[model samples]
Target: MAETIFADRVLIGGRIQKDVLIEIDDGRIGEIRINTSGNSSAFRVPSSCLVIPGFVDIHCHGFGPDSFGAGFASARRATLAHRARGTTSLVAGLVSSDTEDTSRAIASLATLTGEGIIDGVFLEGPFISVARRGAHREGFVRPVDLGLLSHWLEQSKGTIRMVTLAPELSGALDAIRFLVREGVVAAIGHTDATYEETRSAIDAGASVATHLGNGMPSLFARQPGPLLALMESPKVSCELIADGRHVHPCLVRYFVNHAISGVPIFVSDCLGVEGEGKHIALVSDRLVEMDDGAVVFKDNGKLAGTALPLSGILKSSVTKAGIDLITAVSAATIGPARTIGLEDRGKIETGYRADLVLLNGTSLDVARVMRCGNWVVEKHEYE
Candidate 1:
C-alpha cells in the first residue's frame, strides 16, 4: 500500500518549507503536495519535527563492530547500524592490504552492493603514499599498477566506485586517467604531493580529495600543499571527517565558506569502532574513550575515526561548526551524492527514492528513518 507523510517542515530545494505532504509508492516518491489538506489516511509527523532526505556517506569504512575486511556478514551488521543512525546510503571503504586480500574483500562486498545492503566500494589504499598513510599498514602501500587496479575493479564487478591515490607516486597520473576512463572517481589523498603534482592529477581527472586534511601534509605559509591545491581546484570535491577531531571545526567552516567547485562532503571515515558500542583494545595501537560524544584516542588525544554518528555530525555541523542548517544537511546529503554520481537519491522530490529521516526540530536528533519507503527506524510503532 502507498503511504503519505505530512510534515509541517520539509527540506525541499535546499530549504525548509511548511505544510508539505510526500506521497510514496513502490519505494519512490509519487508526488509532493504543498498547502493542501492531507489525505485522511496520511501519517502525520509531529508539528515540531522536520523531515529531510536520508544522508549519503560516500566514504565510510565500517560501523558498530563491523569492519570491511570482516566479510559480508559483518558488513551487513555495520550497514544496519548506519541505517538506524539515518545513513540510508554509503560506500564500503577498504583500506590498503595485499592484492589477494583486497580482491577477496571486494568480491565479498560486491554481494552486499548487489543486494542493496550498501551502495558500493571505495578503495582507499594500495596506491597511496607511505609517508602520509595514517592507519594503513606501511608495507601494503604501493605504487599505482594499472594491471592490479584492473583486476580489483573486475573483482568488484563494477561496484568499485572510487579509488584514492597519491598524485606524486609513479604512474599516478596514468592511473587517474585510467580510472576516469573506467568511470571511476580518482581521489587524491594520503599524499605528499607538491602543488604542481596535485594540479597535474586534477588535470588528469582526479576529482576528489580523500579526507582532505588528515592524510596530507600541513600547509606552510610560503608553500601551499595538497590542501590548497584541492581547495583551489574548480573540479574537485573534498571529503571532510566532521567528527570534530580529524579536522578542526574552524577549518571545516573555512572550507565550507571558501570551497568554489562545490560543497565539501562530510564523510565518517569510521573504522566501525564506536567506543561506547564496541570494546576494542587497540584501534591502530591507540586506546579510545567515548568522550563528549566523540571517540577520542586516549594516548595522544587524537581521533580514531569517529564514534560520532552521521546524525551527530549533522548536529555538530549546525551547532558547533556554525554552518547553516540547509548547507550542513547538503554536505551530508546531495554533496556526497553528486560526488558519487547517485542522482536518484540525496534529495526530497517527486520521482526520487523515498529515503528520508525525521528529526526532533530543536535537538536535531534522528527520530525516524525511512529507506526505500520502508520504515527502518521508527520512534513510534503502529499496531
Candidate 2:
C-alpha cells in the first residue's frame, strides 16, 4: 500500500522546506512535492511539529559487551530502546576490555549489524592511554597492537566501522594507516598526545576525533594540545557528546560554529540502559555511579558515560548548547550518517529510505517515530 505524509515544514537536503508532501512507495521516498496545497487526505504532521529525518548516532554503548554484561539479547534491547525513541541508526560502542571478551562482543554486534538492528561497531579502546582512559579499565589499556587490531578486524568481518585510539601509543600511526586502508574510521581519543603527535596521527589518516573535549588532554594556550590539533585539521570529524555536560555549552557553540572544519557530529554516548542508563558499574568494568546528571567513576570521580538518550541530546543541543536547529539536526542526522559512509536512510530526500521523526517544535519532544514508512507503536500497545 502506498502512503503519503504532509508537513508544513519538513527538513530535506539540510534545510527546511515549506508545505511539503512526501510520498512513500515500497519503504522508499518516491516523489517529494514541495509547496503542496495542504493535502488533507495524507497523514498530516501537527502544525507545531517539525518533521525531520530519523537520528543517526555514531557513538553509543549498551550492546554486546564491556561492563553492561554480555549477550546478543541485551544488545537487541539496547538497540530497540534507541530506535523506539527516534534513533533509527546506531553504532554499538564497546569500551576497552580483554581481547577475548572484546572479540566475542564484536562478533555478536557484527551479527546485529548484519541483521540491520544496528548500524555497525565502534571499539572505544584496547589501544588508549591509561592516564586519559577516564571510565575505561586501565588494566585493559595498552599501546596499539597491530596484531590484535588485525585479529579484531578479521573477526568482525567488516562490521567494525570505527576504532578509537591514542596517537601517542607505539605504532599508532601505522595502525591508523592500516585502518584507513581497510575502510574503517580511525578515531582519536583517550589520548595524552601532544599537538604535534595529534597532527601526525591526522596526517596518517586518523579522520575522526572521538568524543572530543573528553577522553583527551585539555586545550591550553601555551601547550595547545590534541584538542587544538583535532579542531584545526580539515579532514577530521569531531564527535561531540550533546547531553550538555560532556563539553561546556560555550565550547559546544564554538566547536559547532568555528572550531571545526569537518562535520560536528552530536552523539549520546549513553550506556544503553533505557532511561538515564547511569549509576551502574557496567562501563569497561570500572566501578561507577551517577553523580548529578552525569555518570562518573566511583574511585576517581571521572566521567564514565551518559544517561541521556539521543532524544535528550538533541533537545539539549538546541536549548542548552545554543546551536541552531538546522545545524543541531544535521549533527544528529545527516552528519553522522555521512561520516560512516551510510549514504541512505538519514535524510528526507527523494529516493532515500523513508525513515523519519516528528518532534514538537517548541519542546523538541519526540512525538512519534517512523522507521521505513511505519509508525512506531508504543509499549503500552505492544504489551
Candidate 3:
C-alpha cells in the first residue's frame, strides 16, 4: 500500500494546531496524528496557510454572468466558475419567476444535479408575498400550494433540497407539511407575516428563515415580526448574507449572539453576477449591475445579487466585522453543509472526502483549493 503524508497546521473542530501529519492512502485519510515521531515522509503546507474543509454555499443562485434560470449549459458553466472560488459543494438557488419559467429552471438544474456539479437546488420564491418580495417579480408571487410544490419537487427527482415561501398565505401550512413529508427543507421568507404566523409555520415544519432579517419585515416594538419569531424559535435555523450590504454589522452580531447557536447558515444569496466585470445581470429581464463591490439593480437604488465572493465574505466577517475566524468559517461551511443534510463534505475529519481549502492565516486569501484530492487551486509552489 502506497502512502503519502501531509504535514501542516490543521484546523480541526474549531482549533488550529501545528505539526499535524495526515496520511493518505487511496485518496482517503488513512491516519492522522500530531507529531507521533515516525519516519513518515512529510509534505509541508505552505507557511502561514491553514487547511480547512471546502466551503458549502447552500444558497448561491448562479455563477459568472449566467443565471441558473437561463439554461442548463449556462448554469453548468457558471457553477464551474463557482468551484474555482473554493466552493466544492453548493446548492443552486432560484429567484421567483413565472411557473413556466421556474419549471424550465428546475428542469435545467435537474440535468446539472444529475451530473454531480450541483449537489441540490433551492427554489427561493414564486410563492412569496409581494409586500416583502424585495426583488422578486410581483407577477409571479403567489400563495403556497402543496400540489404545485410537489409537481416541482417531482420534476427535480428528489434533488430539491429547499424552498423559501411566505408562510402566512393560504395553503402555506399544508405546503410546509407536504414538503417536510417529502424530505424537503421548508424556509420562511419574503413575507409580512406576524410573529404568530411565523411561529405557526415553524410548528408546521418550516425550519428556516431565509436570509433572516432580510427579505422580511423588520422587528418592530409593537409587532415583533418574522425575524424576532425565528430568533426565538428553538426548531428553526436562519441564514445571513454577511456580505455587509444585505445587513448591518450590529444586526449580524446580534444574529450570531441570539438565534439558534451553531445552527444558522450563511448564504451568498448571490445573484447571477458573480464574475463578468460589471455586467448587469437580468432578473425578469431587467438590467442589474454588479458594481462597486456590491450587486445593485438600477444604479444603486435596488440591491440585487452580491459581488461578494465567498472568500471575501469570510475575510470581511473576521477582519472588518470582528467575528471569530472559526465561527465565521463555520457559518460559511459546516452550518450550510449540515443545514442541507450533506454530511459527507463539511468538516475536516476522517472518512470525509478531502475536499478542502487552504487560506492565508492573516489575510484570508485562498492559498489552495482541493476537490476530491485534485489541486483545483494552488497559491504556493510545491516541488
Candidate 4:
C-alpha cells in the first residue's frame, strides 16, 4: 500500500524546509514534494515536529539485557532496543574475547545482518594493542594475523563491515590493506602509535579513527599522537563517543570544528546496561547506582563501555557540546553512513529508503520512528 506523510518541517539536502509531503511506496521514498500550500487531507504530522533521517550508529555494542557476544536472542533484543530509540540502522560491535568466542559471535551476528535486523558487524578487536586495551580482555589481544582475520571474515559470511586495530602493531598496515581490498573499513584505534606510525596506516588505507580519544594515548606538547594524525588526515573519519562521560565537552567542540573530515561521526559504544535499575558493588568497596545511567567499569575505574543511547547522544551534543541541531543530526546520520559506505538510507530525499525519525520541535524527543515506510514507534498513538 502507498501512503503519504505531511510533515510541517522536513530535513532534506542538509536544510529544513516547511510544508513537505513525502510519498512512500513499497518501503522506499517514491517522491518528495516541498512547499505544499496548506493541503491538510493527508496524514498530517504536527507543525511542532521535525522529521529527519533516521540515525545510523556504526559502533554500538549492545542494549537492554542483550549484547553481541551473548548470542542471537541477545543480539535481537539489543537491536530492537536501539531501533525503538530511533536508530534505524546499526553496526553490532564485538569486543575482544577468546578466539572461538569471537568467531561464534561473528557467525551469530552475521545471521541477523543477513536478515536485515542489524546493518552489519564491527570486529572491535583481537587485533588491537594490549597497552591500550581499555575494557577488552588482555588475554584475547594478539598481533595482526592474516590467516585468523581471513577465517573470521569467512565465518561472518561477508557481514563484517569494519574492523578496528592498532596501526603500530606488527603487520597492522598489511592487515589494513587487506581489509580495504576486501571492501571493509579498516579503522585505527586501541593504540599507542606515534605520529609517523599512524600516518603510515592512513596511507595504507585505514580511513577511520575508532572512538578517537578513548583507548588511545593523549596528545603531547612536543610530539603529536594518533588523535592529531587522525585530525589531519583528509581521508579519515573520526568516530566520537558523545555520551559526555567518555569525552569532555570542550574537546568534543574542538573536534567538531576542526576535524579534517568536516564532521565527526557519533557512536554510542553502549554496552546495553543503561536503565537497568540495579546497584553494583565495585571492588573498591563502593556502591554505584546503575540508575545514574553512566558507563560501567571494574573496581579500578577502568572504563568498560557507555550506557547512552543515540537519542541521549543527540541531546548531549546539543546541550552539553554546543553543537547545532542539524550538525548533530548529521553526525549521527549521514556522517556514519558515509564512513561505512552505506549511501542509500541516511537522508530524506527522493529514491532514498523511507527511514525517518520525527522529533518534538522544542524538546527534540523522538515522537515517532519509521523504517522502510513502516511505523515502528508512534508516541502519540501510545499516549
Q: Give one clash count per candidate, in the order shown.
A: 0, 1, 0, 1
lDDT at residue 41 of model 2 (Cα atoms):
76
Candidate 4, RMSD to the unseen true structure: 3.0
Quote the positional error of residue 193 for candidate 4 in Å: 0.5
TM, every model: 0.94, 0.93, 0.92, 0.94
In order, candidate lDDTs are: 0.84, 0.84, 0.77, 0.84
- Residues 180-206 of candidate 4: C-alpha lDDT, one tens digit per residue: 999999999999999999999999999
Compute the lDDT of residue 195 as modeled in candidate 2: 98
In model 1, state the lDDT of residue 15.
77
lDDT, candidate 1, 1-383, per-residue tens: 78999988999998798898899999999889887767789999888789999999888877656777778888887778888889999898888987788888899899999998898999998889888887777888998899999989888899999999999999999999999999999999999999889999999999999988988988899778898899888799889887666778888888887654645988878676533334443554456665655556677776556755578788887788788888888989989998998899899998889999998889998888999999995331110
C-alpha lDDT of candidate 4 relative to the true structure:
0.84
Candidate 3 CA-lDDT value: 0.77
- The candidate with the higher lDDT, 3 or 4, is 4
lDDT of 2: 0.84
Which digits, one per residue and each the tens of the lDDT, describe model 2 over residues 1-383?
78999899898887789999999988888899998775667998888989999999888886212222265888877777777788988888887888888888888898988998888899999899988988777788977889999999999899899999999988999999999999999999999999999999999999899999998889888989999999988899999997778998889999999889887999888774332333454445456676544677676777776866677788888888899998999999888999888898678988888889998889998888988778876442111
Off by over 4 Å in 1: 274-280, 285-287, 293-301, 377-383
Could you tell me how far off, in angstroms, the CA of residue 300 lies in candidate 2 after the best superposition? 3.2
